[model samples]
Target: MGKGPMGGGGPHGMMGGGQKAKNFKGTMKKLLVYLKPYSISIFAVILFAIGSAAFSIVGPKILGEATTTIFEGLVGKVTGSGVGIDFTYVSKILIFLLGLYIVSAAFSFVQSFVMSGVSQKVSYRLRKQISEKINLMPLKYFDTKTHGEVLSRVTNDVDMMSQSLNQIMTQFITSVTTLIGVLIMMISISGVMTVATILMLPLSAVLISFVVKRSQKFFKTQQEFLGHVNGQVEEIYGGHNIVKAFNGEEDAIREFNKLNDQLYNSAWKSQFLSGMMMPIMTFIGNLGYVMVSILGGYLAIKGSITVGDIQSFIQYVRSFNQPIAQTAQIANLVQSTMAAAERVFEFLDEEEEDQFAENPVKINNPMAGVVGREFQEESNKKSHHHKEAEREVAVVNEDEIIEIEGSVQFENVHFGYSEDKIIINDFTANVKPGQKVAIVGPTGAGKTTMIKLLMRFYDVNSGAILIDGHNIQDFNRHDLRSIFGMVLQDTWLFNGSIKENIRYGRLNATDEEVIAAAKAANVHHFVKTLPDGYNMILNEEASNVSAGQKQLLTIARAILADPKILILDEATSSVDTRTEVLIQKAMDNLMKGRTSFVIAHRLSTIRDADLILVMKDGDIVEQGTHTDLLAAGGFYSNLYNSQFEDSHEEAV
Candidate 1:
């Protein structure tokens, strides 16, 4: 039942070779902290496992008693001695052995059950922590990491930790208990045979160590190639249409085949090397078993040990090497688990955004300058006149002492994605409440960078952006973002009904309000044409709807938000001419009463903008009304003129 020391599960143990984790000790120590909560359950598991393995360890000795009894009975009968067989003694030993195995099985079952729950609970908590960590991490962290890599840490790495931790904990306890109990029983029977068995341990260990050392490089390479192949598949599949359109199918296949072949080579080599450990360990174990058996028989013949003792010692010697092999396997599994845990721990340890202030800004409130209800009477009393008292009541209703005027200004703002390279340099702009300010620039210009700075996606290296005369940093990120809404060229709609997508901008918006917003965005008619109207479900990528329709939905979302400021990033760039006209009209309606920033490639769209900020290489080269800039015959005029010239050249 216990594999008698030489028996084992499989050679998959060696497949974990070459994965010696960096900072393994520290990672394991940190991982153990997560286990602290389940200490009681883990303790119970260990106890049950030890009991189970101990029962198995003692079974062979008891069975040996029965064997010796049978042998003696036969010998006595042949020699014509009195009272030849002790039937009652043999019967009792057989019954006790059966009971021992049953109890051992029960203990093992309980250990597995308890360990299952502990592992699952830890997995749940790890996932919860990762979810929270995602929100806490800054955008910059995501910008630097691949989405697949991040997801692997969350899903694959955590899963590995969960599975390996469960098995390792139970096996480690059982193996140690079995090894100890078996050794003690062997020594009690025949010390000489025990010493002979122990001598083979060093040889078995050295052999395992050699194979593991050779296989580690293969394992690491296999993992790397596996990742490369997976990435290639994901990229090629995700862009299948593009690849086909470009007639690059052969190239993609060739690259994939190359990576696949490399992965196969490493995988095969690693497995072969790891597989060698099992048979090698088995051979060494069998050698020890043979040595113990020979000495055991000699000792019994010389009357130094009984036949029963010889049988039990042989069983011990046979079982000894399996635990040693198991120990080596567990050690490798631990290294693998630690590597995964390190990734998870690193994610958990990422830098988080600043804590929200106790008294966060209230720009979302229409009357943001108001204090609170407690000061209402005092403010009313201070302002005696009726109009003044009314204003006082409004002022007292809001907590933060900030007004919501929606006037935004960039005051000598300078910023860069990286510290060493400055992308936006000492640029400044001002937009009055309800003004439409358009930013126009060449491909390398800092139009989007300016928008990102305004939204605090990336903080400026120097200077500041202000809303209603208060520095952007003065407002909590949540409160600050709540005051502005954005509709970008890339529309994002989750897997939900069209109505739900619109309601996402303002979660508490009613069905009627959603319809009104859709109507304002000119997508209401299109929705009505669908069988389910607003209830139509969008697919995961929102591909069920047309690109233009998706754009309209986003605009509808932005309109529903009713933010004090709006940012439109090429919002109508992807639509057909007719759809573009509808989108432009909807966007105009959305921006009517909000201070808006528009970044558009189309010069015609921004011709009527209140102020046009023309940029080149992070600098505001020209800033004025479109007519004024065109009349001045400067960079703005040339940029505006080049559009028609390019079209003419293309037509020719």
Candidate 2:
């Protein structure tokens, strides 16, 4: 859970503790724009709140009328000049007051229901938009922020905004209405007492302002430390095993305690200061009551006001201070809400990846109809040697289908994660259709970077990556990606059944097709052994499966995709020697008619590659066949020889 605006002490603690927005007015304007659709609902809430406050405010004044009636009747009875009391009139007043309160309560309930709906609707829209926005955001944006930080904006910030908006809207209107209504009622009772009550405002304001100013820094500190604490806990929890293995538990605990102590210090100070507000305001309110009582008594003695007027005046004075306090609390809440809004809007406004091309060139697979039919005929001729179930044919509409031969060219490609540092500089490569090209390099040789550029995860600072002679950027990103399949060193499997995870490659694939793809990647036998067979659910981390098994599942997914181009970035790195050989055979079958780029640190695996590109410091220093590279006795020869030496030494 993310931290909200108000921490341990609740709303009162947040009176002056909430962080202020950098651009309060601008953020508020944007928020109002977002609320435009709910304007009518919000307006209804305001009207209902005012109506509720108005009825509730009128009760004290009307009840005072009954009080005056009883007092006058009692005095008359004592003098033996009139009836004792007007019980009938007092009863009527009480009945009317009861009806007014009932109506007020009904209005209050309706407004609350409406406002609750509006706030929830707003939250729903925000979450939906944020979820959508995440897809559109550039990969670069996520590179700079943690997953937790991003998630906090979605969960905590949005939640805070929704809750605060709900309270602020209704409470603001009600408080203002009550303050004004109470003041009017007080004036109608007696001008002198009203003036006396009004005098307490300045003193109350001074005390509040002083406390707020003094506690503002502590509140800010508290919020900052709270985030630090949450971040630390999340980080440590995620990597607790690593920390323990490294004997860093004491360090982690010491760091946590430091942050915890700072949070405690600031929290207590802010909470204590904010907590003082009620007592301070209460003292001022009590002083106002005393002043009003003295003035009301004098006025009553002079026959300038009745006992009922005095009673109403005192009630109005009490009501007056409440709205003032509520307004103060609301001000802080509004600020907090705006701050959360700013963070949400900031994410929504981030630069999105250019997903679509203005004039997209449709993919035209020339081999779909004529070549495909010929291939099927060829397979039928060889049916005696191969099982009928092992042979497969794709039936696609010739008019709608388009495919590329998977020819790729990197023409003077230059790129860097940042402009100041050029990693892949003026790199060039050409891969023929259906050719297996191996990329071998050291750790930071820009091997993965090249794949990223080819996939358009990031564009080159200069030069072009062409697919089937069309610049990659010219094709729609989605369309370009559709022709490619990737099985990376780090396998990613979502929390789903094994069958569903495999089907993720092609969502509409039938169970038979999924099983065929799994069998092709050599994962079918292992999956069948699981407790629920293909129905076995992988946990969130997929920890139930071995790393090699995870890799095989990903390979099965890629096979299911049946991409025109295949990228295997150390795809068999995690598997044992036997499994690696099996995977290599599966990969060989998968790569037969597709342009495949294999990134491998194990030089032995890529011995059969059509072309080996030896890269060093971002440039391909040598390009040749395995035997030819060995004959050249250059960088590739040295790297291959070193690997052999390491293996030989290990065996010895």
Query: Which sections of candidate 2 miss by over 4 Å?
Result: 1-6, 12-18, 76-79, 364-401, 575-582, 648-652
Report the lDDT tens digits of candidate 2 across residue range 52-165: 999999999999999999999999999999988999999999999999999999999999999999989988888987886786577788888878678878888898888888
TM-score of each: 0.90, 0.90
Residue pairs with clashing backbones, model 2: 364-402, 364-403, 365-402, 365-403
Which portions of model 1 miss their true places by more than 4 Å? 1-17, 82-87, 357-359, 366-398, 401-403
Q: Give the Å error, residue 83, model 2.
A: 2.8
Q: Candidate 1, residue 116: CA error in Å? A: 2.5
lDDT of 1 by residue, 370-460 (tens): 3222233343343211122233112223444555778988899888889999989999888889889999999989998898888787889
TM-score of predicted structure 1: 0.90
lDDT for predicted candidate 1 compared with the true structure: 0.81
